[model samples]
Target chain A: MSNTPLLSTRGLTCRFGGLTAVDRVDFDVRPGQVHAILGPNGAGKSTLINLLSGELRPSEGEIHYRQHPIHGLPAHRVARLGIGRSHQKTNIFPRLSCLENCRLAARIHLGGVIASWRSRAAARQVDERAEQALATCLLTHRASTPASAMSYGEQRQLQIAMVLATAPTLMLLDEPLAGMGREETSRVTGLLRALRDDYTLVLIEHDMDSVFALAEQITVMVDGRVLETGTTAAIRGSEKVRDVYLGRHQQEQA
Target chain B: MLHRYPKRVPIIMLALTVLLVFYPLWGPVLIGDGSDFFLEKLTLMLILGLFAMSLDLLVGVVGLVSLGHALFFGLAGYTLALASPSYSAASLWWMMPLVMLVSALAALVIGALVLRTRGIFFIMTTLAFGQMLYYLVSDASFTGGSDGVFIMFKPTLAIGELTLIDLESPLQFFYFVMGMTLLTYLFLHWLIRSYFGQVLDGIHDNEHRMQALGYATYGYKLAAFVISGVLAGVAGMLAAMQYGFANPAQLGWHLSGEVLMMVILGGMGTLFGPLLGAFAYELLHYAFEHLTLYWQLLMGLTIILIVLVLPKGLAGLILDPPRLRLPRVGVGGLLRPRPAASTKARLGLAGHHKHEEG
Candidate 1:
């Protein structure tokens, strides 16, 4: 992987009223690496993902993708710039079929203008891309099923599939394994591992085992601020990270 | 596209089309008395159906419920009245396009401002703009104030030596309106099944998801608004031509509310539903008017009953019939305990059940 960050943020901050959801934070994800963001609840990991995905504007900071500043851009514009994100809430179109959910994400590359009166079936490229994404996420069998009809695990897979369909160069996933059962978690971890070689991933996850298994680099956040950033080995051995995060976990386990 | 509809819906739609096609021929004989009056009423219903269907494109498909949709309808009618010369008929070829353009421009401007807000705020803003126009025409001297203006002559469609459509004749005008309604239906049918329509459906289902998927939803909504406005304008122009007059009432929120009611009464998302709604609403309105002085009360009760019985509206009766099931209210049912699972799971299963039925 290249040393140059595919997406990098300097002094990124987001404050909601008096509460600083995400304090001034400097973070980066290099190309083709699974960079995991680990934090406890309310540590502003999701907020950081929201800022990077352009879902929320930062109160103070600069976000650069490929060395060009992209702060203050709308989510749609940010997505167009090859960054995609999945929500912690599994935000797929529940009423639409799985294929349609992927097709919508895939069709963005077809341009925004309403120039055609032909049937959606005629847009073979969009359908193919959608199908391909479903295949990649192992959701091809559920293509015709409505998203709401799918199991929670399958829905999570559909979420990643949707991001995949966008053909994004960089992906920001928030809690992809948030509520998955053990089987679903491993399945999604497999999917993420498969995706690692093809696209850069910024993952915010509570599951440390998957984070350690899949992520080459890790960033831990505590109270909306980055606690530390290092390789998996360094973070696993870091004194500060253990004292604040992992130590607490070990104590609870004991 | 055809496969998406219920089996009975397509057959029923075909039967309806056949009935409409033959209505102008046999309708007069069936009614026997006041054939001309009935014909005019039917024509007006068709025009209003077009208007209601246009609004459905916004409310049902794009998920925008504009309370001032009548603005385009009235504005176009006024355009027709003002553009017509006192002694001569306006050219249909030029005037129709001009009126539609005017409505489109108004929609573009209004859509830009109101689209920034969503839900109830959007509705209120649209209603405010509509009311503003209503007062402008009501109080402005050039627009004939509250008195309104008359199109002295009907628009004419003519070639070098041939006249194709003469809107002055009731029968010809009726056929013209029927043709326009069919065209709009077909156009919308094609549009809603297209890639553009899929995007609209996506927006309606989950706009935030669509935005995250990289769609500039504002532009799509604006386009739908303009298209809907242009269609409503066509209906408005036809109404003005038929009545030979334009008034502030046409632009009022009352008219907008009526059209919205028609959409809800028929079925929101289905294009054919609004047309069905228009015919049903107008026919009921005509029937109730003759039956009692408090027709509005009866009408309100009927609407409430329909809403309670067929929540999806009149179109839903055919497209998606509600399952009839007896309520479990006997002693055994009352004694039984409710499921202890989370309500979310129950709701999800209930949604799935409904989806299967539909």
Candidate 2:
């Protein structure tokens, strides 16, 4: 709610043995903003998200969430702090039904943590919130369907819905449209655009059109460090970005 | 839609308990000759059934397969025999309490030690500890050495100037065992349906995810282990009381193997699977022992067939797998069918409307 950015990382660094996966990467994500972190394969985009999500501990640097230090917190604690994320891989409770999946996430939002033997009232609330989340992704009809039965695109939608049920202040979406077909991608893009009003999303995406359309600000990463960060237009016209990333593709397309 | 009979489950259990309690009364007319012997066998089966259920709680539901369950069962028997007077029937009151106390203590100590390791190491360690106890009992002279201690008379309950329980009466004793089984079954059912049960399921599915989700997986696992251990101990105490003797064979690895087979045969995770498996297996054993002298061979072959044929156990086939159903929603918020199916359902709805109009 404050003018301060929703999240800020100062000198964030991570090391795996002798290799550095994320190196002194300083980044800030403002409130109610769509900030996309763009990079090619093996560019530490995933590593950065893992660090921010508290899946991996940083070797050095501080991460402040809503102006409070949250670097060393566990994944659930980070989630409880109003930060929700979907994994790069379709990470969900596979055997559970679509509604059950959302219910699991929704329970995190409804007062206390949900255990297996929850009261009927808590169970009902979970079901209700899960249905609401499923509606948001237009998959409410498939609420009783198992996760395994869903198509790849629907699985992606369910993943987003699960994250949404957590009621996060900032959503870290890792490749939301990674393996979607054209129609599916457009549908998801439209959905993301629609959600822009209620959510401040930080997306790591490969789809240029969706990124450009949805993101107000873009930061480029190469070899685990932030190469540049600016408005979409500024990033588009950056000579260094063109020479390093876009040069080969721009020429080939032309 | 056909409604599930959730209430039927408990009703059936209550009926079965009543039948078991009065089994001797009817067993004489049904089985004909050696009715008392058969009832005794049933009592043994009931105790073993409880033992099997305890294992199922750990292996089937909690996802911790243990091979040393008989250790608790046999240990309690040993403790009861050692405490009771050898010259006469052990005082049922003293021996029963002692069996429970000693068995629980042994299980707690053993469970704590074995639970520290996991996977194959845990299995092997528990097996070793059980074998060690068996060996110690077999070699010890004061504990009747390898031959085991016997009871001169069945235990009886005495009240001042009033008669109470006569353990020699098969009907009275059978009811006692039945009561214990029902209590154990109900307690276990409640336990697995609790929040603790849910966490165990989560741990079973993905332990790391549970830890990341802020659950102390270690504490949850330990609690489940202790609960299973205590249940096994109670089964052992009842076994010792029923037989009026404790044998070194009670501690043998075969005892553990038999209980495990019962769990697997009945359906590891299913609620009543243990009871089913125990009864079926025991009855089969009785029939085989009478029909053929080589009952052990038949028992081994039958267990092999059950394992090979139904790895998920009998429960998976009988109980039906858990299914997910959609919650009822407001009419306006009803989920639209897939765009492809929408037209067909809409046509069906329209047909009903037109019929009403006509």
Candidate 3:
């Protein structure tokens, strides 16, 4: 378990008709490491994340987590096996209170959903854990607030908190900073930094600044293929990465 | 702090008290009075109310709008008829439990199979399964082979005194039915407010989100479907007992349609909505039966009118549906902008954390 990558994908390929969404992509995230997958639009970064999280099955290759294959398992089963994923869309339970969203997720982690319904004692304990999760997410003040009524940034935070409540050893975040204002992003980034030691995080982001700032290891993808993977500094220094991604920076200056 | 007891108990008790007390006194027609017509109507209403609530669990709470609930009810009726020694002879009290168990088992098997499909496919699949059961019972000689079976006696208590429930006396049967109906309501209310109930709501709002939260939504939906089926089945058994026989007509599509109408008319999701719908529906049936022989035609028209006019159902008119309300977050709570460009601020902190770990 010490040497094993929290999540590793080998030759993972997903094809839709004649077009390939992800083509023979190999990726890995070491334990407690923040691995960022960076790509332009339609670059298959999301498809790769989807495959790793068991939301989509690979047409080729295998996905291993903690040395066990998890390629074709249902998303819920994958979550149960210690991988928590937040969607690109803010997908927290809208009707549920902010606390309830986290609590239900935590309850799933404890495997008490079945007994919790009939047993008052079990439900009380789950509620307490849910409250604790809310506090951990800096959402204690809005514990009873419905997720539907939260500001866009708050909703995003709640989505991440909901995933955290699952108690996953590995976290898969698809574009966590997609729609956030600068302050919100900073607050969330601070929270993400605090979370670094507790779980392995795989983040997909178009925000270069956030990616460059957070990623220990960075993988760049283009047209469904992995172009490069290395330390962020190494990747930033690479001529290919500059030509493929940072060319836009030159174009903007021109 | 409010987690110690079932959340909806007090509300259910209040409703039951009003139903049991006022309805018997001024609601007209007592059982055992040669024409205990009103009492009989009340008993029928209670049975239908139970049926509607069962359907509501699937549709209102679980978001599975099913059309085959009556199949469980009708099948239970047939079970009681086949098991009893002559529809007139009193069946043992334990047999009622047996009937409910069998009906519930049928629901479980059926729910498990059909729950695999969703949306229109789910509705159509359940209807097909229900029709298959109806035809099977109608054709089978053991269940009176389409003509239906008559009970020789009412159900009797299995206790020391061998207390037989006298269905012949409308008042006794009325009280018994009322007690069972109230119990079913309470049980269902408890179930809906429990942790299981919240999960059901989650599944309803967003199943994908629930699954991601680590819940096996499929299992929860199947369980809810079974619970609803069993309740409907019990109501069916009671209906058979009251009517003194089980008929092929009881298993018909029209009966299924009628129950759907009752559910919608009362209010699809409200706890007392179904009971109110049943009461209104039964009263309409009573009036129509006296006024015209083609009463079903008028009843069908009435339901269509109700659907067109009050799509939210009766309960929606009286009460505001629950809404999500977030208490305002004051300005002091929101994080203020940092001086050195927030992204850079975050980057420095993230870098420091990483370096410390290294």
lDDT agreement with native, every candidate: 0.88, 0.77, 0.79
Each candidate: RMSD: 4.4, 9.5, 8.9
lDDT of 3 by residue, A31-84 (tens): 978999887789998888888877788899999988889988998899899888
Give the lDDT ranking, best first.
1, 3, 2
The C-alpha stretches of model 3 lying farther than 4 A from their native spots are A1-3, A117-125, A248-254, B1-20, B27-35, B87-92, B162-165, B289-301, B321-358
lDDT of 3 by residue, B1-358 (tens): 0112333545554776676656656554554453456667778888888888888888888889787788888888888877877534544566778887988799889999999999999889888887887888788887777788887677775466556556667787887888788888888778877778888877876787777777888889988988898888889989998998898778776777778778889777665677678878998999899999999899889988987877767665444333334443887434544344446435434433432332
TM-score of chain A of each: 0.95, 0.94, 0.94
Give me the displacement of residue B141 in model 3, in angstroms.
2.2
Candidate 1 residues B218-329, lDDT tens each? 9999999999999999999999999889999999999999999999999998988999999999999999999999999999999999989988888878764554455587
TM-score of chain B of each: 0.90, 0.81, 0.80
Query: Whose TM-score is greatest here?
Result: 1
DockQ (Cα-based) for each candidate:
0.49, 0.14, 0.28
Q: Which segments of candidate 1 are over 4 A away from where they belong?
A: A112-122, A250-254, B1-3, B323-358
Expressed as tens digits, the lDDT of each residue in A1-254 for candidate 1 is 57899999999999999999999899988998889998778899989998898889999999999999999999999999999989887777666789988988888865443322344553677788889999999998999987877887998899999999998999999899988999999999999999998999999887888999999999999899999999999999999999999988777779
TM-score computed on alpha carbons, candidate 1: 0.92
